[model samples]
Every structure is written in C-alpha cells, then in structure tokens.
Target chain A: MIGCGWGLVYGVLNSLSNIMLLPSAPFISIRPQIALPMAVGILLNPPAGFVVGFIGNMIGDGISGFGIWKFWNWHLANGLMGFIPGLIRYFGIVKIGTVREFGILQMSVVLASGIAVAFAVLLDVCFLHHMTFPSSFPSWILPAFLTDAVNGFVLVPVILLAFRKILLTLEIRTICLVTILLLLAVFSTAVSITLSILDDLVSQEAVIENFYIAGIVSVFLLVVGFLASVVFVRRFTDPVIRMSRASQEVESGHYDLSLLDPVSSRNDELGRLSRVLQKMAKTVQERERSLRQQVQDLQIKIDRKRKDEEVREIVETDYFRELKKKAKAFRSS
Target chain B: MAKIIAIHSFRGGTGKSNTTANLACLLAREGYRVGMVDTDIQSPGIHVLFDLDTNDIPYALNDYLWGKCDIARAAYDVTKTLGADATGRLFLVPSSIRAGDIARVLHYGYDVTLLKEGYRQLIRQLPLDYLFIDTHPGINEETLMSIATTDVLLIILRPDQQDYQGTAVTVEVSRQLEVPEMYIVLNKVPVRVDREALAAKAVSAYDCPVVGVLPHDEDMLDLGSSGIFSLRYPDHIISREMRRIVQRLTP
Candidate 1:
C-alpha cells in the first residue's frame, strides 16, 4: 500500500516535471521530480523506491497517452535509478554524519543516473535494433543522464534535510555548501556550452562532441575541487569551532574539558589554545573552591584588619603607655 | 611568695569575675593559698560569685583605698563560702558595693598606685600563694594598674568582632607592661565554633597564646553571674574549661 501511494505521487511528480519543459533543449524538461524516488530509496528500502519509480513513470506516460509498453525500458531505467541509491541503506549510513557520507550520498545519485542511462542505451543497441551511440547520444542518452544526475544531486539532499534525517553539523554544512556551489558551476558551464553549440559553430559534430566531453570533465573537476576545499576548511575550522564551544562551557563554570582531546593533540596554535583553556578552567575552579572556604570563615565579611588598626590607635595612647609603664615599674618593686 | 594574677577584659559580660572566682576557688580547693581582690572598684561583681552580700563586706577595698582602714581589714576569708568540699583557704578583698560608696569612689578616684600597693599588702598579709585581681572591664587607670603589676595576666574576651579588636589591643598593652606570663581565655563562645581555628586565629591576631575557649553553657546563662559556674556545675564544659584555665595559669 505504501509503495502504491508513493507510486501515485511519483506519477504525479513525473507529469509535473514534463509540464516544465527545458528552454535550451527541445525534448528535454527540468525533471527535478526525479529526486522523489531516489530520495525515497535512500530514506526507505529499494523495493519501495523501484515500485514508485516504475509505476509512477508508467502512469505518467499513460496520462500523456503515450505507449507505455513501447517505451517499457525507460520505466525500467527509472526503477533502476531508485533501486540503486536504496543500496546506500546497506552501507549502514543511518544518517549523514560527515562530509564523506554526504559526498557518498550525492555520488550515488549521479552514479545511478549513469548506470540507468547506460542500461537503456545498451537495450536499444541489442534488442531494439537501434545503435544509440551517434544518434540517441545527443537526444536521449546525454539529456537523460545529465538532467537526472544534476537534479537528483541538488534535490535529494534538500529532501533529506527537510526530513531532518541529515543533521546540520559542521561537516554537513560544508557538504551542503559544496553541493550548491557545484550546482552553480555546472549549470553555468552547461549553459555556455549549449550557447556555443547554438552559436553556428555547432555544424562540426566533432567540435560539439568535444565540447560535450569538456563540459563533463569540467563538472567532475568542479566537484573534486569543491570536495577538496571542504576537507581543507574542515581541517582548519573544526578545532576553532570546538574551542569556541569549550569556551562557552567554561563560561557556564563546567570545567570538565575532556572534549578537546582531539583538538589539543594537533600541535597547532589552536591545540595550544585548547590546552591553555583547559588548564585555566581547572585553575579557576580550584581558586573558587578556596575562596568559598575563606568566605565561609567570615560570615559577616568584616574588615577585621582595618578595624584592628583603628582599635590599636584607640588603645595605644600616651596615658595607656604611661599607665603601663607605671604598672611595669610597680611590678618590679 | 604570692603570684599576682590579674584577670581583665576590654569589654563587660565576658564572665571575667566568674572566671576569677572559679580560678581562685579551684586553686584553694587544690590546697593552694589563693587570695582574690576585687580591684574593679567601680563595678565590683566577684563577691556575687561567693554570694557575699554588700552588707557583709565589713571593711571594703574602698575603705582601704581611701585610707579609712588597713587593706587586710577588707580581705574576707571566703573559702568556707564554697561549702565543705573546699579543702584549702581562700580570701577575697571585695570592693565597696554600697550605692553611696560606689559613687564616692568614682567621684573621688583613688590613686592607681594605691591599688597596686594594696595588691602587694593583701598578698603579704594574707600570705597567699596566688593573689588574683578581678579588674574592671576596659582601659581605665585602675584596670591598667592591675594589669601592669601582675605576674600572670589572663585577658577574657568573647568571640565577637568588637571584642576581637579590643582583645588585640589588650594583649599588646599587657605585653608592653612586661608581664611574666599572659594568656587569652575565650568566653561565651557559640557551640558551633571551630575551637582550634578560633584559638589559632586569636593567637595569630593578638600574638598571645590562648589558654581556653569556654563554650556558652545553658547552665551558665541560668546561673546569670550570681554563683560560681565551676562550683555549681563542676562537670559542665564551662567548668571543665575553667579548670583547664586554672591548670594553665598555675603551670
């Protein structure tokens, strides 16, 4: 029943994607709804994701009055897209805890699109009596792969974030930023490449194909560079974030600072700062304990030293001296 | 030879006279010939510890200080006042408690030298081993005289902030006088006081050794300075501390 319900919703999303047709490519549409089944796959189980994707794509084609049986391989392709990402569940990633986990989540999305599209192109080559390499590569294969990968990479995390399964830790934040920036870089590269193709320089098939290959290479480079920067930022900023949190703990008078052990071991300036803060907090706690005991001794907080001085002035007078002398002399007698 | 022991306080209600009475009584009970002179002529209260009525002081220290009678005539044999348990003799030279006479002595003050001289004569005349002077509270001429002439000086003070200031001054002044021995006796201390801490504080603050810390006893409050606390409740803490004081003063 769950599968059927999601399948209907996926079908609705599929038709919705078709309504917003791509402006640059004639047959292609902005299929952000492709993320629905992929996200479900990672969140739930693979069978559920496969059912949703296959049935939903079938319903979508049926609603448009297309021959669902004629293009049955595309439905299978969509099901494979969902089913493969659901295998991330077997990686035992209960949640996206680190930048690496988030990177894997996104990598799996694009990988699923690559595999599913390759499978469809393969089926067309052998069974459907069409060589997809030169013909369908431009129209079907490239369009489907690029659109699904890009859309799923950007939209799947958003869905998971909204579900609160991916906690916004420092690592997650860095990964999210990398994802957004990567999307922008890829989108701009794609637009320029498409514009170049439309610029009358596209008559050369080899040049257009080289540009397509360059665009794919640059996207990989952008993703790699952004992920490397995430690691760089994490190495530098993680200790600073930990120290700031430790400072707050000290301000609240909680001096147990075993939390900074990793930060303190780095031998960096941040590590020195962590060690200093831990020592200072312990010293302050000891001083406060001693001060509390001293305070307990003096209930009224009297200025006994000053008062004693004043009393000495009052009693150590000329007459008191003379009298003491007289008595001292008298005792001698 | 009698040792002149002056018990003085910088403030009143420190149980000074009671301490003197107890020390003198305990000394006499221990077979030491002890004589206590009420040199606190202005506010003499040592006689009350012995239940010695003002009417019974036939010839008071006032008459002796005023040259109206010999100082020995004023010294009353008060050992029997402690009842049959008292084994040795004790003498107390009481000050004039008469209303007219108290006014007279205050108005026409006697010489501090005369009180010093009288202490000597009473010690020799009574032939006492110990002559205890119960000086009046505060830094008056006669009290200073009594403090200065003493062989042993025991300053009584409560564990009070005000008393701390004065007790410090008293210890300094007594030290200046070159008394052979001096000690502090903390009196009327609250029950919860850390006694060792208080003694250390007192010793460090005043530069004097502390002999005893007498906790505030309910029985002492009940007695209200009318009778000797050590005699009535010998086993009580207050009495026990008084005995310790006597031991310290004697040793």
Candidate 2:
C-alpha cells in the first residue's frame, strides 16, 4: 500500500516536471525529478524503488494524455533506473562512506542508465517496431540515456549527502567542487548555443555557418579546460597521496629519509608540506637518537651511584663489621 | 628449580609490559607452567594486557607485600584470558591498580626481601616451570632486589640513545649482581635499521647477547597492550622474533 502510494505521488511529480521544459533549450530539458525514485529505491528497497518508478511512469503517461502503454518500454526503463541503484544497498553498500563507495555509486548510476535505455530501445525495436536502430538511436536513445544518467548521477549524491548517508571527506569535497564547476561551464555553453540558434538578428545562412563554429569552439574549450583542471588538481592531490604514504612509514618507525625526497623537492604548497613533514621526521629521528644517548648517560651515572649505595649498604651492616675485625685478627695471628 | 626471569627496561614505553605478557603467554602456550608477577606497583598495567579485571582481584601483589594475603592467594588463574586450551597452567600476580594502593606502595615502599620471598612462594604454590617478573622502569631498590633474585635478566630497550645509556647502566649493575644469564631484547626497532648491525652494537655496548630485535609493528601498536601480541598474531614476524627470543632464553 505504501509503495503504491509512493508510486502514485512520484508519477504525478514526474509528469509535472516533464511538462516544464527550458524555453532556451527545448530538446535538452532538465529532468531533476528522475533521480527521486532512484534515491528512494536505494534508501528503501529495490522493489519499492521499482514499484514507484514503474507505476509512477504509467500514471504519468495516463495523466499526460499519452495512453498508458504508448511508451511502455520507456516506462520499464524508468523502473530499472530506480531499481538498479537500490541494488547497491541490497549488495551491502548501505552507505557511501568512502571514496571507493562514492566511485561505485557514480559508476553504477551511469552504467544502469546506459543498460536500461538500451533495453528499452531493444524492446521498442522488437515489440512496437518503433525504433529504426541506426537512425532513431541518435535522435531518441542517446538523449534519453544522457539525461537520465546525468540527472541521477548529479542528484542522487546530493540527496544521499543530505540524508547523512554519504560522508564528505576531503577527497569527496574536491571531486564535488570540480564537478559542480564543470557542470556550470557545460550548462552555460549549452544555453549560449541554443540562444545563438534562436536569435532573430542572425540571417539563416550566417546562423548556420557561425553556430557550427561557435559550437565546435565551445566544445574544444570545454575539453581543454576540463583537462587543464584535472592536471592542476593532480599536482596538489598527487603530493598529498605520497605524503600520507610517507607519514605511514614514519608511524611504523621506518624513518628512511629517502622516502620523502621526491615530494620535498617540489616548489608548490605540497612541496612546502613535504618539507615540513621531512623536518618533523628528521627532528623525531634526532630526538630518538639523543634520547637513547641521554638514557645511556643517565644509566652510567646511576650505575656509579648504585655501586656507591651498594658499598654503603654493606658497610653499614654489623656482619660486614664482624668480617673486617675477623680479617684483621687473622692477619695479626 | 623454577626459573625466575625479570624483564626490565630503563625507560617506560619500551614495550616492557607488552613483551613480558607476550613472553609469558607464549611460554604457557608451549605447555610450560608459567607465572607472571607485576612488580611495577606504582603503575600496575600488565594485568590489563592479561584482561584481568581489577574488581575481580580479591588479593593483589600489594596485599601479599603488605602480608594481608598469601602470594598464592594473590595469584589468579589467567589461563582462560589466553582464549586457548593450555596443557600447562598460567597464573598472574597482578599489583593493585587502585589509586590508594599505588600511592601507599610508593609512599611506604614494601620490603624487597618480602617481595622476593613472595615470588618464590608463588612459584612453589603454582608449581610453575617459569616465573616472569614485569618490573618498573629504572633502577630502584625493589627493581635491584628482583634483579638479584632472578635466574635470568632480560633488559628490554628501544633503538634510541636514552635507552642505550640507561641499558648500559642496567647491564653494568646486573653484571655486578652476577646474574647467571643476562640478555638484551631490543624492542620497537625500525624496519630500515639493520637488525644484525643493531644487535652487534648492543652486544658490544653492554657485553651482553642481543636475544631479539623486534621491528616496530603496527599490529602490536593497534593491540595497544590490551592483549598478548605474540599469541594473537602467532604468524606475524614480530611473534616469530618473540618465539626466537623465547627459545634462546629457555635454553
């Protein structure tokens, strides 16, 4: 009963969100609601997610006046989109607590989207005879997969994080920050391309010629910028990784100075960090050496003192006095 | 005759208590009747490594030292703490960890003669093959007494300068006492340090044989002296080294 109610609510919401398309970019509509059922599935159970997604899509189609079975394969695709992420939880990935889990969640989302869309298209080809493979794939299947996957990937983490299911460590923070910036860049470039094509001032011929150039140039910039950021981030992250490894070595008493040389030589913040770490390690090593020397010296001093104390302890005794007298008397005899 | 071994270090945190506990457990595991006495009354921690509850201890080494109870009465059968079936029995004479007991022991200081007698009584009552004494760090009156009475003196030290100097003094003192067998067990040695070279250096420094050179082990650190490391990680390199040290000490 609860699952059916959730499905009904989600179906209505999906229909409402689908009706609201961006004016500037009609074809590339924002469908943030798709990730709702996916998050529900993951947090609850796979079947709950499947029921909500499948029933919701069917109800949504009925409400939108597109006969419930008009796009039945697509409804199944949506159901699978919710169901696959839920399996992550089912398979003992109950929380996205670490970098590895975070990676798995993202990859699973993308993979599930691809598989579901491919399944839907195959069903369409087989039963409905709607898709014509090569021609229709670019127009229909590609967009469906990209939109759902991207939406699910972007939104599921946000919801999970809000629910305190995913921990935000330094690594996750860095990745999220970079991803948001990249998404902003892509969103703005796409909006600009759409606006350029829609602008009335540009003649048809001019629009056709310059729009292609603008699109190509923006795409080239995006790729180059993405690569540049990745490299920049790597410079900082790589040293941190190495420094952490070196720190572990120090922890286990493997104070080999050579382990830190590569990082210490760099001329950046991480280089400074490496230098500081090396200094700390060196100080600790020196302190250990000095500590041993100090203890050894103390021991020598204590040994001398103990010998004196030992002699005093024996001489103070009556037995030692008797022995001394006996020795003197024996010598006299 | 039951062999009495006093494991001491000049400095604290040299894994003295940990090594003593591990050695005792391993000895017992090998089907030898082993008994351990925590002589570090000021800071009785070896009991924790054995997982002995303070509340359960009706009589402690302090009680025996104060003549409140017999040494055998103070000894607890700690074989169950090892979590294994031992053909040979294991007993522990833990010192009182109570704050008042610690302060009292430090302030009044028990008779070294009585403490030594208590150890002998404990061994006799338990019928132990070996009795291991975990001593307080540094040379004190009680520590010297324990050292004098023990058949073997195992001086534990880290690969550090402070330990080196302290151990030198201990070695010199023990030599004067004429301990039958004195061995050095270097603890928390770094991985990169050449074990052979360090052992050689230690041998020359004190004219004592280096019985074991244990590497700084993460598992040991993680265990945090809560339990015996050697018994817990029998196949670990540190445990292997510990077993080797035991072999040398036994013979």
Candidate 3:
C-alpha cells in the first residue's frame, strides 16, 4: 500500500513535470521542479516516498501511453533522484540540519531537480527514442531546465514547511501517515483513471478527445492526491501550531495559556503535535516559576534594606544623646 | 538489511584502521560478506593491511567520489590473503594513497551527501552483511555524518590522558547525535597496568560498555599491516579478544 501510494505521487509528479515532451524553446514550466520536493519528501519518509515515487512515476508514464520502454527509462532516472537522496539520508551524507548549514537547500533542490530532469530528457532522447545526439539536446535542454527550476522554486518550500511542521510537532507517526496517504493516493488515482476509461468507452465522442479529457481529469486527481495528503497532514498540524504558540506565550511570562484537552490518538498528526505542545507548556511553566522566585528575592532585599535604615537611624540618635550627657557632666565638674 | 558499522575515534593513533581491517576479516571468517571503506581520504592506509600494494589498487575511493568510477569498481576482494577457506568475502574500498588525489580532495571537499549515497549504493550492490567505515579522527563533517548514520559506533582508545580526553569529546558528540548504541574498546593497553582496573575506570568515565582491552602485543608490531592478525594467528590472545568483539557484533 505504501509502495502504491508513493507510486501515485511519482506518477503525478512525472506527468506534471512532463518528462514525456521535449520542447524546443528554453521556457520554464513550474511543474518539473516538483520532483525536488517529492525527492526531499521521500528522503524524510523513505519507505512510502521511495516506493511511491519510484513505481508511481513508472506506472503514471506507462498509463499515459509512453510505451513500456520509455516508462522504464524515465522510471529509472527519476527514481534515482529519490533513491540517491534517500541513500544519502540513510548513510548520513545529508544530515538533518543541512538546510540550516548551507542555506542553499532550496536552491540545491532546484539545481538537482533541473539535473534530474535533464538526465531524464537525455535518457528519453538518447536511449529510448534513439534521436541524434547533439541535435536533440538543444530542443530538450531548455524546457527541462525551465520546468525543473520552476517546480523546485515552488514545490520544495511547500514540502519543506510541511515536513518541518510534522517533525517539530510530532503530529503524526511518519510511517503511518505516509502509509495512509499513499493508500488514499493510489485508490483515488485508480478510481479516477477507471472512471475516465469507462466514460470514454460508453460515450459517442472521438476516442482521442475523450482520452485527452480523461488524461486531464486523471492529472487533476493526481493533484488532488497531493492535496488530500496535505489535508490529512493539516488535520493534526493546526492544533500543534496553536499549542506551540500557546507554549511560546507561556514562555514569554504569560502563564495563563489555556490547558485544553490532550489530542486524541485517532487525531493522527494533530495528536502528536499537541503532545509536544503539552511538554513545551510544562517547560514554560517551570521557567515562569523560576522568574517569579527571582522577583520575590529582589523584593526581600528591598525590605531588608528599609529595616536596616530605620535601625541605623535609631542607633545614631541614642549615641548622640549619650555623648551630650557625657559632655554636660564634664563641664559641671 | 545490511548493518552499517562505522569504526571511528576522535583522535588519531587509536588503531582505527587496524581495528576496522581486523573486524572485517573476523566477520568474513564467520561466513558474512563484509565491505570495508577507507573514508579517511587525507591519510589512506587500510589497503596495506590487506597486502594490496599501491600498484595493485586499480581504483580507489577518491576516484568514485570524483565520479570517475562506480564505488564497486574500487572494491578489492582479499579473502585469500587471510589464509583461511575463502568462503567469506571481504571487499576493501580504499582511499587514494596518491599525494595528488589526497591534495585535491582536501583543497576542495566533495559533497558529503554524495559520499553517503555511495555507501548505500555499495551495500545494495554487494548485498553486504556489514559495511565497515574507517573514519578520520576528531570532529569533522564526515566523521560526524558517519556517526549519525551508524547502527553501531565503536570508539577505539588507548589508556593515555590525551586519548581519554579526546574519547570523551567523541562520546559526547555521539550521544548528541543520538547514536543507537556505542561502545569503547581500550586498545594497546600496556602489560604493566592492571587491565581490570583500567577497564573499570574507562567504563566509569564514559558510562558506556567496554567491549575489549587489547594488550600491546609484540607479534602485532612485527606483522604490522601486512596481514590480518586474527586470521593469521587465531590461537593468539589478541585474536581471541578480537573474536569476542566480533561475536558481539554478529547478529
């Protein structure tokens, strides 16, 4: 199921990225760069993302009538993008704080996405299509670059933000959420594709036109597949954000942050996020207590200083009177 | 799934290379396919232990990192050199001993992430039971990265004040990285010192398990890096200790 779901994501990303067509102009489409975010997402959650991206892209291309040969080539190339990053994460090449380290993770994604798309185009034109080498390069390079760059710029950040929220809040068990999302994506894609095919067979319009409409709808469903994943992720994410904000308020000396009900286990991502927020709230409360103690200590010091001043005044007056009596006695003698 | 064990120390002269080579041999002897990587690009020497002369190494880890060759191409199988029944396979992915390659890599560091991908690719391609990473000493980008990914991190140290202080730094970093399991091996312990007392002190200091207390052996000095000690002299006491460590590692 996880494999199938990731496969769906890969499929949609591949289709949208349009690895199939090699445009002659150097125009950038905002689609190919989605591969970068998808690749990064897989790196974060491997089992689901890997299988989905790997097999899904292949299946997506296959169903689009790219022929089995082209499908495998594209699959191998795109799958490698996910596979390489996943391996790097597994082996500790790309550490957790890479984005913080280089400040170019976003840029790297765009660059790498462009490279992957370029490689995919190379594979398509060179290996699969058997086009003449340098001649075909001009036609494919521009479009691949533009599309990949756009996708990377747009999609990488969205995925990164989603991952950050999920990781920070502990809103969902990564494995479970990935599994569920992958299943939904696969189910939806299958249903949508099946419906389109049935509609084309039953209706009286030209098959190509019907198929085109079906393709568009399938692509739409794929987009929906990603949206559905976002929705599922968001369900648990919002409360985590609220709870974290509340904890931050408490940290800033606002002790009255609300203590709402603990997130339910069934709440998935949101539940995990809430649990973290609860811990943060406890920490904030501890800090606030410490601050209050420090304030009390300051007040005690002031009170002590006031009492000491009064005692000093009383002692000084008594001493002066005693000295005056002594002086008067001496003068009488 | 292959268990990727990265053999590391915070400082040099902790016997990291010797330990990695010996452990790989031990694992291979026990009917496990093991691959050893010499990631210490600056000072590569593991190849000598496998009796692989400079001329014999067709490709090195440096070549693979530079995209000149696939990682597997650099792997040198050295089971026959151990003088055991060659059923177990050991592939040595050595670093370039050439001064030029070393200088180039130091001047311009390759992508750390790419090295990681190479490690994974080696495991997948070879279907290795264990991949031993011989790392450079101290806290560097590569060492820290390897420690983060390892299933088992073995820190080799000698019973010296400098080594003790350095080991603490490595241990703390490993702890921060949240390594799943960590152990310390007290290597080259002098015969004069009470081994038990030293072991106790080490355990108390690090608060981690001590797998072995290997004595400084004259035979090891004589053999040097020509051959694996455990394989050549299975009856020796050091070999026995090494085997015990290997047993703990084997699943």
User: Model 2's DockQ?
Assistant: 0.04
Interface RMSD (one decimal) of model 3: 32.5
Give the DockQ (2 decimals) of all models.
0.22, 0.04, 0.00
Best by TM-score: 1
lDDT of 3 at B1: 69
lDDT per residue as tens, model 3, B1-251? 68878888767877889989998988887788999999999998888887777565789988888899999998888778656566778888988888899899999988665566777788889869999999988767677667766778999987776677667767765665567778889898866556666777778777999888888899999998777888788898788889889888887
Tens digits of lDDT, candidate 2, B66-99: 9898899988888986675777789999988888
Estimated TM-score for each candidate? 0.49, 0.47, 0.43
Model 2: residues >4 Å from true position, as ranges? A1-333
Question: Proportion of native contacts found in each model?
Answer: 0.38, 0.00, 0.00
Instruction: Give model 3's DockQ, 2 decimals.
Output: 0.00
lDDT of each: 0.80, 0.79, 0.67
TM-score: model 1 vs. ground truth: 0.49
lDDT (Cα, tens digit) per residue for candidate 1, span B89-178: 999889888899999987988877888788778778778899998988987777777777899999998877777777766776677677
**True-vs-predicted CA distance for residue A179, candidate 1, Å:** 3.7
**Candidate 1 local lDDT, A1-333, one digit each (tens):** 676688898887777777676654555567888898898888888888888789888988777666576667778888988888889878878788688788788889999999998887788777785444687567777888988998898889999989876876656766666666766677767766766665666468867666787777677767777787778688878888989999999899898888988987865466778899889989999888766754454332236677568557745788776775576577777
